[model samples]
Target: MKNLSSNVTERTERRKGEEEQENTEERERLENNRFEDQDETTERARCEWDFHLRTVVSSATAASDALGVIEFGPSGELLATGGIARKIRIYRFSSLVAAASDADGGGGDVALLDHASAYDYYICTPAKLSSLRWRPGAGGRIIGSGDYDGVVTEYDLERRTPVFERDEHGGRRVWSVDYSHWEGCSVMAASGSDDGTMQMWDPRCDGGECVATVRPSATKTSSVCCVEFNPFGGPLVAVGCADRKAYGYDVRKLSDPVLILDGHQKTVTYVRFLDDRTMVSSGTDGCLKLWNIDDARAVRTYKGHVNNRSFVGLSVWRKGGLLGCGSENNQVFVYDKRWGEPIWVRGFEPTGESGCERGFVSSVCWRQVGEEDECTLVAGGSDGALQVFVGTRKPS
Candidate 1:
């Protein structure tokens, strides 16, 4: 009788454990389904956006054609463009809109060709410009640029002259330059170069020498193609390199990278911080990877743009959680952060002209938005064409 009672108790306990396990499995399945539903809703919203071309501007001279980069000022009041023409063109955002409005309801196919009246002023650089960045909290008075001459220069837009210049890459071509506000006040800058190193600079350091330098890896002979400081305010900095990987490091500790994102089959051309804990990296392997630093792996991969080689630009609109990049097919692609597919694709030519076999969209940027219903996108073509697009969501 005692043996029978013990057996009965054991059976009861096992049955209860089995029931709890079944319940847990059911909960997991339901939670996964719930997430799938939410993703579907977000994707539907992304598909409902409509973007239209607002303005078109092209190089004025044949000698200085082929734009490489385009950037908007911190306040979105000014636009700066640079390229193989070795000239930095500055245009007032209001002026571009006024010109567009005067054309045809601000949505004409009219192309402004080297129109002197369209641009406020232009600066001639020593070499082809590769990248442009506007200084943070400077009221659009200062802008920095990287050039093929292997120099990083900061220009005072108010005076139209370079206020600071650094030539430490040994003429190996400075591919990217970015600024960071450290300790809430100290302004620091960084540049990535073909020299396979990213150097940090602080103007207050007295002699203009870079304060620190970080390499991608000790064994890899890869060039540092792009560098980005965390826009959300932190010591975290990331660099994309020719070794087909992106490395994330803390500015306070440069001895080793805290995270390594390694899925690209080709060179990683660009890196942009999506938030404090996540980032997006673009590779010539024809895909964009969304990485979670804590996990030390890519959370998602975004593909649709035709990028196999060349530095097609990558820009993120944090407010909208949208990623914008140029395609080798002379088109612009926009992707929602939650989806792998592109939400929109538009050709650089507004009139649907088909002579783009030799040209591609080399640079793209989304205007930073705040409390606005509409957003602006600017893209640059290899042939020195600039197109501005305005995107808005359709009323549901």
Candidate 2:
């Protein structure tokens, strides 16, 4: 009886030891898995940066005219390019859609079946597409284009034709057009002409008439280069002019620019509202300045590009905290707003005079895709080509 009792005790001890060993192994396995997951996340972020660096390797070439401006559709699935060629070209977003589909299928060929399709090029010309914009809330199926001839045309994707056409500026070149965010068809457009006048139009009315006209103050004489609507609220307009000043106007009362932002020594080429209270402007001075709308003061200055005396394009990614600038020097600078410095610089290699023009960088914009926060930067230049830069955040 004593030996049997001892044997039972030994068995119990052995069982407990085995159970403890099993628990330890399980814990180790879980720890290993957690480490692997962390490693994967880090590697993924590095890969994304690498991909962004490589995607623009050859300097994308699309348009064949001195490109004036580039705009991305709401879904980032389409790109609208305009330039001296008097035409607007649309490029599809097949690359992103295909990549997403592949990622969903375990990053394998199985997802190719669901890959996004490419779009055929659509061209609009004769009116001289000076500026292009995608209608808000339309999912990128509608586009509004302003012409050097002071005409505004709204085109539908399905019909591939202008649904609405109006010319109210009396042949003054329409420099910029913006659609309201809440109402797709509600548009507030501005035109700057050789006559040195700035006029606003609201196309939603039956007889599209000039909503307001802005003129220079007694001390200033400048041609309006560009005009943009404030992203915040209300009917505020920001206008940049050849006289090297940016003016903010409340369309309701066009007595004068509410604020006169003067910093550029040369012509101010472009001005875009970053948010409700902040705006950015670029000029021939080769400097990009950030302004405070409330006080009408310059807060920050970003100067890295060369040959700003000519034309340059500026685009800001409000949420991603990025700014893309293209200059006449044939270079594109991508800056992190937080650091106030460029994180990456890219340009085309000179190839038998086929590279970006030495003194012309026309337009730039950040292309937003689907629901993802990722965006790609695109620029247009005098070489009549479009260049795209994909952006990614560094891993933590």
Candidate 3:
């Protein structure tokens, strides 16, 4: 019977797919990375925070999500940027101050900060970078970067040389990378890739080899969009997945996830710990949620910033309950977790003014306060522009 044979064949194909998904989960589960804890943390709240846009700068004209990367030195004295191009640029904070004084394009007291004359160097990667992070140490002279080619390279600015490199993702592009240091542990780095694995690397090891691998997804076919280590001093990591699930895993035991949070309507683009007990996650579905990790449940959901499978960054405000993220509509959005909607979202037309490049805002970070005299917020996106924001909080 031809009809009977066709039905049986269809059933066999469906079963095969299910089996493959299960095997993928099994293989990826036994892997792990040193990205700061991405898991929901359990900690006390800090003081209230206030933030506002301040400066903007750019080197190229065209838009590139790859170029929308920006990072501050550990001490906040220097800033580094590069992604779409093969070269990375470093600038001194004071140099930006000097630019603020320039008459022609110097943007008044605090308009656009341009210190492009500071430093520039080429990276050996064949493709553009996807992520960049500065190593934490006394001088913060070393930086780690992941590229579209699935390679991870560490550069030593003090030595002006490539310190180490490796590719453990089967030639898949790396999406995110981060470094971490425990009180009595060797420094380690974590990189998430399109290959559906997040691998950990030890710098002191020969050739900076991968120490462990983890699969924080329900199925092996899902890609890891973001990975972070818990700064609360644990073996746990929070991972965002293309499958629309965010998982919590302990490196010590990758065979099983400690917790799984699923509710996003699309790919989970970013996941970061708000504190030791709470985590913030964003999805292409256009919803940002804060989860109380203790119970593995959603505490609140904030909306406004749009994401269509983009790696948007999220950071907690120091004072009380503020959260910030970049938007697909070329804006920087900040919300109070206490509210259901964003407090405000701001951007300008791409008129080529100092910080007015109205391209999709993609990457964002909150500058550490002790290192920065003021509460500082920074973001980068499609237009290859770095926009900076300063907080205006009156003293308590």
Write model 1 residue lDDT over 130-189, tens digit each, in one string: 999988878888889999989888888878888888888889889999988557434888
User: Which stretches of candidate 1 lie above 4 Å from their native place?
Assistant: 1-46, 60-64, 106-115, 205-207, 350-355
Candidate 1, run of 10 with poorest lDDT: 106-115
Write candidate 3's Cα lDDT for 1-396 as tens digits.
999999999999999999999998876664422122222121112223465555666654433434546777878777777677666677665555455446235343445543244344344445688877887663687888888888888888877678788877888988888876554343877889999988888877766776788887658889898887776666667888898899887766667788899889998877877778888888898989898888789988888777776666676654445687888778888776766577667773363434444367777876664433356667776666676776654466
Candidate 2 segments exceeding 4 Å error: 1-64, 96-119, 137-139, 182-187, 217-221, 350-359, 369-373
Best by lDDT: 1
Q: Give the clash total for candidate 1.
A: 1
Every model's TM-score: 0.87, 0.74, 0.78
Q: Each candidate: how many clashes? A: 1, 2, 22
User: How far off is model 2, as Cα RMSD?
Assistant: 15.2
Each model's lDDT comes to 0.84, 0.68, 0.72
Winner by TM-score between candidate 2 and candidate 1: 1
Residue 73, candidate 3: how far off, in angstroms?
A: 2.1
Cand. 1 Cα-lDDT: 0.84
Model 2 agreement with the true structure over 190-301: per-residue lDDT tens digits: 6665346677667666545777777753433456778777766656778888877888877767896788998888888788777778898888887788899999999888
Candidate 1: clashing pairs of residues:
60-114
**What does candidate 3 score on TM?**
0.78
